[model samples]
Target: MGFNEDRKRYLAGLEDKTYFMLGDEACAYGAIFAGCDFFAGYPITPASEVAERLAEELPKAGGLCIQMEDELASMAAIVGASWTGGRSMTATSGPGFSLMQENIGYAIMTETPCVLVDVQRSGPSTGQATKPAQGDMMQARWGTHGDHNIIALSPNSAQECFDMMQECFNLADTYRTPVILLMDGEIGHIRESVTMPALSSIKPAARKMAKPGEDVFGGEELVPGITHYGMGQNVHVTGSTHKANGMRDVTTPHVHEALVKRIYNKIDDNREKIIRVEKDISQNGQSKIGVIAYGATARPSLGAVRAARDDGKNIDFMRLITIWPFARKQVAEFAKNLDMILVPEMNLGQISREIERFVNCKVVSVPKIGGVPHTVEEIYDAITEVAS
Candidate 1:
């Protein structure tokens, strides 16, 4: 019997139940329920709970969880685990995430399927180990030092942290690429009610295994299948520019161009299916103000929007669940009915600048830093200021 048999046996024993858990705990549960068979991680502040929970739960499900010497090794281990046909994952914070960028690029180039949970803390040299921040939005996109595209999701609540973890794994398998669950210390540490979905109802996405003699790296399909190392296949894997069969081809101008383009287009071409945003525009035709937010900041953004609405202000709101691929089309369409869009984030203006690129409306970045979350009153004031 293989992993599928073990997975079925593990899931069959689970029952649907509500649990009061931190967002980090929910992330671990999500990975287990999503059929994660391997986890390799290094303990870091605000993110250790994700690894801790997995350490306890994964063995019960016949999975493996190991702590590596460091973040780089943690990332490298998971990528290697992925090539062995395991659903692998890891968790880390700002400093650890930075250390994993090189290997992350390797995973992207090799087209590995893995999930990375980024429990974000204040940063740019460990600004605050225990504090929350959304400063990594751009880093998650461009930190690897290349023109590659990525799939990243941000969760605003503990439930979302759980739900999105499963989605993150599915997206990684479907795209044959690394998927990121972008969490922050605020939500990662906060305790909330999360109802576990029945294990019987779970439909975890499995990677498309490469057939013998087929091109595992590339082919007619934009996203190619993968041949596991132990499946009696002598497949070559490398970080350099490669041909369809996974052999290095760094010198050919066309090969490099085509390979890089497909790596990008695989995700870019499927943006519609990948991008997800929660929109609330009850006064669509009449509302002139709108707010766009993601991660822990979106929690307060929602409260502020509701408070404004209660005071007779018809302000629309958009909460971003899928952070990468930008959700530009959604934002542009969302902005058409409003004259102003307020972006509340923990960073200065990372996403606000992105919103400005797509929409003609005034995109004001309501930034809050210094290791604290934005208060409802603070966001509400920003909304009411524009109204006045």
Candidate 2:
């Protein structure tokens, strides 16, 4: 947890000032940028670049990157490596993401720390490879087939792609949970100039370093924090259910309740500190219209807001940085006195449903899933079209 200047310099040295990277490239850089020393993945677009680069770059930095036979092996390998005391990660798109679900559930039950990057594409089943889609928004949280709470983040810009990694690693390390860095084709393929972040500013925040036998899930002081693995620690992980030591404990209601509650409370306790949403609140809460968007759609959304305002329509904007635990409390407070709340997304109204559950205002969804991002003109028209 303590910062080391030499380690910081080593990471800083990896950044190149003259180079620009695609969304997938930045995704790899961001993970490596966040202290991930091990990567295991099978190639799947539009996320393949992340794995390709890791294979090339990781070894030079004294790290390891492996291309597994398939997504199943990829997921299993990272979990094993993570428990053996390496900070590991893997990347996949929709079909591969589906393949990784069973092992993902294993990671969840085992309380193993790792990262999974899913650069989403349009899909029901291998629906679209070259096309962009956000259909996996719900899948990231609930795809693994269980009643479990998880952490997932969605970044709209290439810069946020890098920044969210710092937060993602922090969440994974602190909770010893599998954290999802969710991106879609637009942000993953799109390229932009990202000024390299300084290590002094972006420190590697890891789990609590207690000997595993000492305490895996420490009391409130280290709530949900991971104690480093050590020999004789005897951690056994299973997908059914488990105790803090990671052994299956399905028989007792108390252990079951305690297991579930600990998972829920640790995240809840950090919600304020973890959840982030950017606001473009208009003056005096007098706005007549509002739009909430995430992912690549947010790019056009900002212009759409401007277009609406120019036509004498009162509009405000909300951009989500954290997706999984939907920021309801903040969204609720922002909805007061608003006539309507609009959600512009690539998928068929995933977040809109969540918004309606919390806010009294009408939730209007402008949804399209064509494997591409919403055009500024289309979004502008949607705003003006809805306003009229």
Candidate 3:
């Protein structure tokens, strides 16, 4: 179908209403509201609800929702769909996400604009399909091969899952790169009341289209626009090194070097514009410690920080909304004059490593694995330990 028709059909399926729903289901509705007309995903725990809902709802909206044989095909299908000039997405948990890495790399290298939702579960390999863990935190940033930059957002609540899915699509389209919504299974399965804003309030990013006679990958614009396959653009897309016209140039040293740098720089240069975080600092401006957390773990950390404040401690809390393309500048500024910073995560010090890179203060990691979130007391104790 044509772009307008697909978009109109998708828009017709949206309703600006409030409802209590699981994060996964909220994500599905968010996709539809965001004008996503194509969904290709394999069923996996905690993330299966997303595909299930889309399977029923997408077709009704005149879109296609295909259950691929496996995660590999699912990831590939979404990339192919994006070339057809439609928004596409897929959802998966740990094992399935791992299976999608190679194709995820292809999507990144080719600059395909699409969304990927990884509802994290306990894992090394199928460690616990139904349990929650933030083990995939680092994988979302580096699971795909080679040196590349990708946008990833973390949603700590069902409302955020509903809200950030649209942001994910916007970021993906705006940059012509795959965006990941790194959600944990706990949040995915938790049900919460969500009030969706008016449809008009959501501003989605439009895809940049190459002008007639312009090379698909050629432009002074860092993120070059793309033309649909049959539009006579004659674009050649490959995972290997390519020139502005998209022709494969695997042997040319300069061609590969230039293309790779452009891809990486597109994100690096825009890092400030992309990174987001929620901060509550010392009101009296005497905070000596800060707590940094993301994903589901941020929930408890927020509570712990509040309790610490009640006890007359100078504690600042920063919740990460953008996980990848780490908010180095923001955190570094927050870290200034602070005695220490504590990071509480569901895994063993994944993002803590990144936090340490940007901050000069004492960085402490409070990791809790085995499919459970850190309690308020646990986080508070860690804060106390570091503060002392």
Best by lDDT: 1
Per-residue lDDT over 197-248 for candidate 2, one digit per residue giving the tens place of the 0 to 100 score: 7655667676665554554643455255454445555555567666666667
From the highest lDDT down, the ranking of the candidates is: 1, 3, 2
Query: Which residue runs of candidate 1 sit more than 4 Å off their true CA positions?
Result: 1-14
Error of 2 at 205 (Å): 1.0
lDDT of 1 by residue, 5-74 (tens): 6666776665488889999999998888888889999999899999999998898888999999999999
**lDDT value, candidate 2, whole model:** 0.81
Candidate 3 per-residue lDDT over residues 132-156, each given as its tens digit: 9999888999999898998999999
Off by over 4 Å in 2: 1-12, 16-18, 217-232
What is the Å distance of residue 193 in model 3 from its true position?
A: 0.6
Model 3's lDDT to the true fold?
0.89
Give model 2's TM-score versus the native structure. Answer: 0.93
Candidate 1, pairs of clashing residues: none
Better of 1 and 2 by lDDT: 1
TM-scores of the models, in the order given: 0.97, 0.93, 0.96
Q: What is the C-alpha RMSD of each candidate to the true structure, in Å?
A: 1.4, 2.3, 1.8
